[model samples]
Target: MPSPDPKIISGNANQPLAQAISRRMSMHRGVKVGLVDARVEVFNDQEIFVEVFENVRGEDMFIVQSTSNPANDNLMELLIISDALRRSSASRITAVIPYFGYARQDRRTKARTPISAKLVANLIANSGIERVLTMDLHAAQIQGFFDIPVDNLYASPIFALDLMHHFQGQMDDVMIVSPDVGGVARARELAQRIKAPLSIVDKRREKAGEVAEMTVIGDVTGKKCIIVDDICDTAGTLCKAAEVLIDAGASEVHAYITHGVLSGPAVDRITKSKLKSLVITDTIEPTQAVKDCANIRIVPTAPMFTQAILNIWNGTSVSSLFDTQTLEPIYEPLYPGLAIDA
Candidate 1:
């Protein structure tokens, strides 16, 4: 017997992203990959309930949910939804979590600290999720926490494309700056992609979410600096790093962050900061305050996620999405014989 068609579903966390992905899938496949109808609700007392309205028996399933802001609530919803799908006899379930929450707590910094990332991984796997897909984890090592397959996608291709477009003729004047030493690898990758110089922001963090005594580790003088990072929560570190880069003689500072957590006062800080612009992806849903920020821009990840999902479903190479020579998206549909309408 032939395998059943793939089914895409979403929890309440990021309905817009899920919808975008579904639209792209339908467009690319030349067939409707419509989102499966489901109802996810929370009780007044804070309990979560999930009900699937369509039959998913023996069908491949993908759940799009970002464990963002209300991390616990969203996480619970994902787990509950997964449970519902599994109980309904779905052949395989993939968790397409654009932003995996508690990822920063992958290891123990203090004596009593728990590895919450590992715990979350266990919760996801135990909930019968057969696979996981996420992007730009705070720490890549968190991939090892999952016993099942985890595809950790990169956002560098997206950022590199945007940078090249914005700096079309001025590529020589650009530099990629990692907000801190730890992210140098990520920054270096982007720099290599755009053929730009690499810089680092060396800083000491006296506490979480705060930076102190930052210094530039490379010559950013007279360069248009692009700070690359995974998450931008609170925006304290980002705003402070932009200030430090400006003081160090950068011509202008911009940021390309993957997950925009934008927690308390992040929008305000980005608005008042020295950065010329902040480019972030729609991995996490943007609030109204973020939408109104004049200097902040949001790029859609639906197309990238759509391609990755198709490649995974078809057992093709997802890494080939980026061309090594040009460092741009290849733009070929993963599904064979499906012409993209111009």
Candidate 2:
């Protein structure tokens, strides 16, 4: 017997991204995923009304809604959509979020502060989402908050490919640098794949939107630097780290961040920073400010994501999807160096 066609529905948050994914799937036979027009309106007193205008009975449903900017509205839309699919008897519902907002509020900094990440997880679970398919979460541990299975996809493979393609044959001179110590693991993974040395920026965050100090922790002198991180919110840390790298005698500095949650004056800062270019995935739709920035470039991940969705539907191992020629290693350096000496 053939498997049932999975339905792909998207909310107002990111219809374009959903459309791209749907178009990619169309290339493969026996795949049928369509988007549902999710029109939302505000009644009196700021109440939200979401209507999913398609039948989904007995079908596997995937709702693509990134809880990005206008986070509450997008999040609410996802919840209501999931609830609608559940009431309509969908066999399963998966929330495909490319950029998960309120992820920074995963923990409480002060007394009485709410752990909104956990709350959001509970809300999605209670709203009848059977699984979650997200990429490069601001906090990886956010997966622990969800009782349902969560597939956290990495943008590293995509970024690595782009970097290799752009650099061509200069991978040996490039070094992957984590903007801060917290992101060493993420940076190390990219470094290992590119066969480049690893470096780290030891930064102290005095407060939100501010980097108190930045200290380079590896041999970056005369080497090109690539800073890797999950999200680039204000571009504060990235800008500061680039300055530190330049001061440390690094020839050039670049950045590859997953979610370009470029809020406030992030674009302006990047445009004026010492960093040559800032590469980001289209996890969140780039604001006009980001698009206008000459130093910013976006790499699409639709193909990667589309394949993963298909793999999940067909009971295939999505892990092997990362090991492909499109994602093949470009650099093989003679020396393997660590950012920090243990």
Candidate 3:
């Protein structure tokens, strides 16, 4: 028998995305899935407050919170809400974090440094969330940090479909480029999906928040170059990479990023850069600046969330929603014990 329909609870980080996902869930199941009302606030003294208004006892709960900008407050909101659901006796609680914050800090590069991503994972797990459903984790290995099931969904499938529809005849003229060596696999998968040639950007980061140089590994001359990456913060590396591509005689440069962490001059940089357009998913709430940037476009991720949540609720396979070669779900467990059938 199918499990009970899950209740959709949202956070303040990305209300638009939450509403879209909630609406789509009802549209798909042909039933209005009850949404539990949640209130999150901060006191003037800097304490966080979260409350779930509706009764969730004995219910399957799904909390939608993107730990995006204002990362601390939003992260607290998600953790506190999960703790509340656990205290309230919710049968199963799954955290739906569209864009996980602190994910980039997954490893330790120097001595006396902390693996902050693992700490965040431990915090989430200790808060009592049985499962996590997130999109395009910054580091795939971070899933091993948690003891729960994580669904790490990819944006490549949707991106490929959109690229095919928009650039049907000119697909041959386009070359998919990874912004760095770390993203080669991601870009290669997308390139294969769209039937385009692959290129890699060899970039060296001098220090935190600074990229020294970037060199293209493959030929981009006379081609329409499309740079792809998981996150775009400050737009520094990406814009510079586009300039390099243009200097290499590429016809045009475009970017398709999964998360748009457009912080600190990102909009200004993008507006003045050589990029023809920047396509990002609606995982992070777009500020007025992002919306006003004529060259930037946003794609909806609600449908993907809807399908994955539905499959989880129905106890069906979600493998088809992940990358074709990887066969990994949105929430992939890093540890062997985290392999939960749910």
Candidate-wise lDDT, in order: 0.88, 0.83, 0.85
- Candidate 2: regions farther than 4 A off: 1-3, 30-33, 324-342
Q: Model 3, range 148-238, lDDT digits (tens) per residue?
A: 9988999987676556555667988999999998899999999987779999889888888788888889899999899999999999999
- Candidate 3 regions exceeding 4 Å error are 1-4, 323-342
Relative to the unseen true structure, what is the C-alpha lDDT of residue 69 in candidate 1, on a scale of 0 to 100?
83
Q: Give per-model TM-scores.
A: 0.93, 0.91, 0.92
Over 4 Å off, model 1: 1-4, 322-342
RMSD of 2: 5.2
> How does candidate 1 fare on TM-score?
0.93
Please report the candidate that would top lDDT against the real structure.
1
* Rank ordering of all candidates by TM-score, starting from the highest: 1, 3, 2
Highest TM-score, which number? 1
Q: Rank the candidates by lDDT, best first.
A: 1, 3, 2
Which candidate, 2 or 3, has the higher lDDT?
A: 3
Indicate the TM-score of model 2.
0.91
